[model samples]
Target chain A: MKHTHAEENYLKAIYMLSEKQESLVSTTAMADFLHTSAASITDMIQKLHNKGLVIYRKYQGVTLTDRGKESAIKILRKYLLWEVFLVDKLKFGWSEIHEIAEQLEHIDCDTLIDRLDHFLGNPYCSPHGIVIPNADGKIIDKPRWLLTDLSEGASGIVSAIKDDSVAFLQYLGKRNIYLGAKITVIEKIQFDGSTDITIDNQYKINISRKITDNILITL
Target chain B: MKHTHAEENYLKAIYMLSEKQESLVSTTAMADFLHTSAASITDMIQKLHNKGLVIYRKYQGVTLTDRGKESAIKILRKYLLWEVFLVDKLKFGWSEIHEIAEQLEHIDCDTLIDRLDHFLGNPYCSPHGIVIPNADGKIIDKPRWLLTDLSEGASGIVSAIKDDSVAFLQYLGKRNIYLGAKITVIEKIQFDGSTDITIDNQYKINISRKITDNILITL
Candidate 1:
């Protein structure tokens, strides 16, 4: 089925909001996430609902139908696979790939995606440490924890990035922090939530609260 | 300045039609090339002209402005690099990469395209034998000849495929013909344009005029 780029983006937003638990997502929440107006979100949601992609209820929210979920996963699968290709194959830094992958996700060729999936050796997860759902949208059930949750002296491998922004990723890259980089927290400042950590037992770096909150880790 | 995908397509069409001799392209010819109406072509050509991408005259057709030509080359460069990645890295047949590349060309990132070019070892020609313009929109000049032009017992390497259709490419692939493959014409059937040829010093195949006209060779 063909969809306008806007419609597809809405489906992806609703899917992500409801990923952890299949719940109805408020239009207001989606509006905030997309940085669009609530009225526009409501309008788009109703359009998606009419297309059998979502179930929208007045004063309630919206939930993806089975068809909608499949579409979202397909879009996400392409995005994640491209991220892997950009980072692993093209040698693009993890932070630099998200925007590029965002553009690549809409290429609309199942054969190309399948070929890339095979070429990448069928990875179980995206470079960001997030689950990359299979053809059936089934994924491994490992939950990721934010780096901000760690206490002083806590150590773990960087599992994923909560903020995949080029600026943030570039900063992390400059500090030698990336997926699978081992880190031990030296201190966590309560005043502003800033974090002082030793990365790979080598460089000691202090990051702002915004940065710490965005780096996910697995203990 | 961002142009819609439609506008970009018009620029590419104008550039391609003008490729051989930098001549003005007629609206009827462009309409024929794009499978659109003359009226629609005039409308788009006007829009592109207003945007400074091309210069159009009433009864005459259009010519790409410097800006328009640059944009077209950029799009073409992305498309060609992806063809290389698909054929060389992902092992897709040369015939299958064009459609996928058509979608990939609009990715809107110079860095991504440049990185891909570097990753693909900076090739000068696409899998189909067209030049891949550099970031600066520069390409080496190499005139290509048609396979149909080859006489009996004449030989050269397969340099490009004029027919980018998957069916034609798949046919060529099945016959073990590809870019850089050596070929010698056994005979050219005069009644029909079909040619019998030996490929790569091994495989012998008889290809219809439809296929031969579309395949290019360089001696």
Candidate 2:
């Protein structure tokens, strides 16, 4: 029932990739995502297949079996819960908690996780606005769109983010952009696709299309 | 420098053994303490010696170098701090925190550990009454004696314990024996070494010499 740290990481990778791709995840894609070699990905995929965690095809790719999906969700649940704890309780910057949560997620103690959930008052989402899956792997996810997708004059609250990289998170932190912050698009530059937006109607600034694309919003 | 989990475990084993023996730790003793083979202990000792973490001499056993001792104390600090957090914040029983702390100690982030120390209000000791080393590996250890050494009519407060095994802890828990509890020895049996004692002037119980020897008390 327990997986190695490497195995858990692979499962999480496949799960994330599957969420976006909606198909079997290629070994090449897995290699790129994990920054590993294709040969190593193939080798690990075969190992996971043998463990009944994944279904691997020679040319097509690999997909998580039911068991593997459960494992991945458990890891994610721990990860997001720890992220909430780090930011909400420990006062760690939101940008600083990802790596720590990455290490904490692999700790295999259901009771500790449950106790932490209670200790944190059972937060519904992480600081990044990502919904935290429950112990039963049930998640309450809502539809959200990238900030760049909104038209001029459109206003909405920040919901989630597509990128969780430190650089991106730190950039948002410096700009006072955070989950649940309200923003209204003032104008869109035709040439660069950048948008001028007012954050809580306090100040206006132009952010690149790339940054806008990563910021999810709920109108 | 970062050490692998296995290397850290070896360092901790050597440090603990050195504390008790006040000399080099034999490969046989290390093997027994780690529940591993002597061959493996020798192999790891040789590896640690190469890494300047330990000094290994043939037949005389192994001892931690200054670098190795620092690593061991760091792990101990994390372990004890987490035990305090689990008991004080998360409401875990004293007996249940040891195994969880054992796993948490290997988390290798200095910032996280320091923040945790601050969050716990810089506690000086763990729930088991063991002095927790600071970030600089400095510890404030008070002198204490095993309960079995006390004579009849002797009175003291429980300060620490020599054994942290779950069984021993659970036994103490069931008998209402805890750190800071006052005890007065009523009778000492000469034949078996078992003694009768009152806990906090609440109840009297007869405990075996093995239990008495493990419980450290401060007069």
Candidate 3:
């Protein structure tokens, strides 16, 4: 079905929220993410439900239907692929790709995406470490471990990051810790939820628990 | 001033046509490029002129104003940048990115392009070998020579291609001649308007004069 950019956005937001929380997404959350009012979210949610792109129960929240999930995944694939293009091809900062990807995700052309996939050499993941689903919505599974989940003395290469914010990515840039960086967990602070890590034998740096959780490692 | 995607498309078509031939863009030509009717082109030209984005003189034809030039360049920048992103980052086939870039150029965000510029490492040209203008519409100058103009036995690296059509790009792909291929001109036959060329010391090939004109080279 032909959907407007706004409608597609709502479905994508619901899909992402549901993925993160593993539950129905609240109207307030949708409203916040979309930067629209709760009333607007309600209206759009109802519209989406009617279109069979979402399953919504009043006041209980919303989730995407199978069709909706497919659509959302398609949009996400475009988004992440464009992000990879921006970062890998255009040399855009990792932090800056999200907003551009948001705009690109609405481009409705299957052939374009497939060709883009070929142009980018069929990347398995985006710059931010998110998997880009193939044309059939299949994602390549990679071995990953969260930084916070690693024990003291554990070591691995920095494979990807969960958070894609420009600020966080820029911080990683400043620290010289990026994708493919070899890292060792030097110490774990139980009290403050922080960790000391060494990168490439250069420096030992302290990172907050929040930052640690955002980093992904591959053994 | 904000312009709709449809409006931008119209202006871009006019701009490209005017650049190629005369300053006066015909409604029929506009319609042909935009896949619309002459009547629709006339309607859009009137609107664009009314908004001071174009200069229209009835049947005499239409031209873009300084403002229209700025707007067109902006769209061009977005389009080319996205093309670079698609081919360079996402691994999309060059033929595939044009249609998608056509849609993405309308996304209204200045920072997105700038950030994309940084992410793509400030590419001076797109995958199709089109020069990418800077934010202020200043084009980056590169030393380039057309394959048709090169003397027989002249050797240079393929820098860009003049043609962007899917069929043409795919043909180049089939011949293993693309942007950045090291090519040496072997023989130029003036009568048949064809050339014999050697690529990377591997194979000597005969190329039609028409194809030769489309290939751009750099020393």
Who wins the lDDT comparison?
2
Candidate lDDT values, in order: 0.82, 0.87, 0.84
lDDT of 2 by residue, B9-44 (tens): 899888888989777799999999999999999999
- In the order shown, the chain A TM-scores of the predictions are 0.65, 0.68, 0.70
Question: Where in model 1 is the C-alpha error above 4 Å?
Answer: A20-22, A142-219, B142-219
- Best first by lDDT, ranked: 2, 3, 1
Residue-by-residue lDDT tens digits, candidate 3, B140-170: 6878888999898899877677877778877
Between prediction 1 and prediction 2, the one with superior DockQ is 1
- Highest DockQ: give the candidate number: 1
Best by TM-score: 3
Interface RMSD of 1: 0.8
C-alpha lDDT of residue A133 in model 1: 80
TM-score per candidate: 0.71, 0.70, 0.72
lDDT of 1 by residue, A87-168 (tens): 7567686657778888888888778888898887676567777778886677666666688888899898776676656677
Position A157, candidate 1: lDDT: 75
Error of 1 at A170 (Å): 11
Better of 1 and 3 by TM-score: 3
lDDT tens per residue, model 1, B1-219: 687888877878888889865568998888998889999999999988888999888887689888988888887888788888888678787656778887888888768888888887776578768788878889876666788888899998776777667787678768888776789999988888799999987988888988888877776
Superior by lDDT: candidate 2 or candidate 3: 2
Residue A120 of model 3 has an lDDT of 71
Residues A165-190 of candidate 2: C-alpha lDDT, one tens digit per residue: 77887788788887667999999999
